[model samples]
Target: MSLPENFNGWEHLQKTYMLEYNRRVDKFFSDVQGNGDLSNVRSSLKLACRLVDGDNEATWSLRTSLFFDVIGYSRKNLSIFYGSNIDTALPVAGHPQLFLYFSQDSQAVPLNGKRLDHEKSCRLTRYACKSGQSLPAVTKANLLDIAHEIKAQFVSGGKGIIYTAGKLSVSYTDPANGFPKGTRWLVNSKSEAIELYGKLCNVIDRPFDINKMNVNTPEKDSTTQVINTTDTILGKQYKQYAYRPVANLRFRYAYVSFGGSASPIFLIDTTFRNTALIA
Candidate 1:
């Protein structure tokens, strides 16, 4: 086939270029809908950007483009489905388009100030995600740090106990913040939320505020006003954990199965999300 005038000369080469971009863009969307960590997606794209620019000197001469949103994964991943016609770096319509837009799927408006999704911030540190400095040698922040890292996101009210028996985090009454109608817990995933709800089932003797909010329906005129913390506005009580912000998190670990038995030491999970030895 003959090349057209606007073909950019290297037709065969251009096809190759677009091919890889197409594959990456497709994979990118798959990960997002899957609700994969935004960081992981970016890491992959940054890797692709490196791989596509391989040893080819001429390819480097090309723009070698991609888009990333500090909020979610790079937009380049989504744009592929629409044929790379994206403006490259501009924000999209309702949300930031070319760039990453921050908004809740439930709400139509874009997140104005600080929108949030669980970034890979789920790293495991020696101490814990909530409590820092369990040990000196283990300094790197891990995934567990995610919960604590985002603690400040919620407004402080009073004192309460956070149930930690299973996967779901125990949310509390944020009467200070419109109870469940206003704000919720800082959970890492829906699984974590489930764990909290499961626990609530057995202990719903009292009208626990946070859990009630999650399970029950908010009043019809429930327009969220301020994101501040309050003291017993709805039903349940209120409490707060002092907030702290952490940039990076660690999720890996080391383990030994046999404590008494003589066995070789072993390196535990790779990414830090999975557990190596459960005793």
Candidate 2:
């Protein structure tokens, strides 16, 4: 496509870019929707960012801080989607994703005529789609579907849990196949997420009175007037109530690309009990 010789407008180009930008922002919130910890998403993104550029801590910190706001926006839109609990890390070398599950064991101790031993067992599964030509298309619309597929293939309907890229993660849920309700708890732990919503107002310099509002809906008698500009109406009463903000976000790819192959690489790690006796 060639640019129009006399075209002086950038609106068309801006619109196209905005479409992609909106898609990315939507996908990010959708994926991080559930009751899981934002920290996991933060950690995963942190590690992924590090793997991409390890020497710039300041840059990474700033970027992730911005990401924290994006996550807040996602949570605001869909408060029901419990966040993810799976442990996520930068995809291992030659791997596109990883899966993990935990199990507990108990044994009788021989010391006091009774044995009591507790142990936790964990399993790791890796899925690599970096090879082969049958690679499925990864796009904004189907991002959530792909995350669901990852859980279906690795976790099945079992207790196994897996981590994903956190894009469209809101779609990965099953009544019988997912983590417990309490497993993805947040609101209590994320004061910053809530504060970010308030920050939006202050950051934009929206001046509202602190004393004249009630979070429980202020009546006319107690309503406070807010002034945005010197000549603007000072009689306009404003009441402050907290609401979630929609995040502006960008989705990034963390996979390695090689000649001709575009599928994500897969790895599966199985755990087995060692029962062999020493001869």
Candidate 3:
């Protein structure tokens, strides 16, 4: 297989460049691609190159760059493609303004441990209802219960609910172990939840009954009333909140494969067959 003129075999990425570039690319993929890692893309690129001629220095380099290019494409478009236009991987609260700062040296930053790119700056908009006045009168127990129920809803993986209430903030602890840490739920508050419920009620033109929530105990009297409203407004709202447009916390991390033999970085393939020939 002939290599493109610009192609250079697997340009050895400095440990730092390899780490930071892969971290951002992986995050973009996870957010947009539904999978946090890209084993398939990486493996496919390598396999495609191997199928051509892995032993050839030029082939190896071209395929390696192609791998990174696919990842780079995702990274460059991270801001463009997301679950929502208004959404961001950074916590919406606090910093209001966020910038990912990386070292200019490129080789300075290390791959391991908490890197600077992981550092986030945000100013949480404190706890307040839509009125921007006071937080709802949701009882702590009720709030905790709601959080627990939401966390429990995802049986495949556990998540933590971050609740900001006035000066004091709390998170849903593991019911089984009583600790407050999990893979997701970095930005959540009781106030936002109450506001969401209120918005839901307004949108559906129905009354929201906390007691009717799955987190609430089924009261026969309330159940009958809610059931009467269920098929219409109440049910729609429930489904909307429980299933559709549910907010999630996105965390960025470097993508790693089990082999650990290949560099995590990816690039665009520059083989003659893949690219247009220069005049």
TM-score of each: 0.25, 0.20, 0.21
Candidate 1, residue 34: lDDT: 31
Model 2 steric clash total: 26
lDDT of each: 0.30, 0.28, 0.28
Measured with C-alpha atoms, the lDDT of residue 35 in candidate 2 is 25
What digit string (tens of lDDT, one per residue) describes model 1 on residues 1-279?
876767665756766866775555444343233323335533454444432434465544332443223323343123122213342421111110011011122232233312222211011112221223343322123322322322222112211122211122324443222122222433434554555433332221123333454432223322222234546758876543213111112222222121122231222322222232221
Q: Is candidate 1 or candidate 2 better by TM-score?
A: 1
TM-score of 3: 0.21
- What candidate 2 gets wrong by more than 4 Å, as runs, is 31-121, 124-150, 153-279
lDDT of 2 by residue, 134-201 (tens): 44422322323433433343343332332211111011111122111212211111332233223222
Total backbone clashes of candidate 1, pairs 3 or more residues apart or in separate chains = 28
Whole-model alpha-carbon lDDT for candidate 1 = 0.30
Error of 1 at 157 (Å): 37
For model 1 the local lDDT of residue 252 reads 25
For model 3, residues 147-225, the per-residue Cα lDDT tens digits are 2332232112321122221211223222112111321111234454354344323322345454432222122221110
Per-prediction CA RMSD (Å): 19.5, 25.4, 20.0
Model 3 is weakest, by summed lDDT over 10 consecutive residues, at 270-279
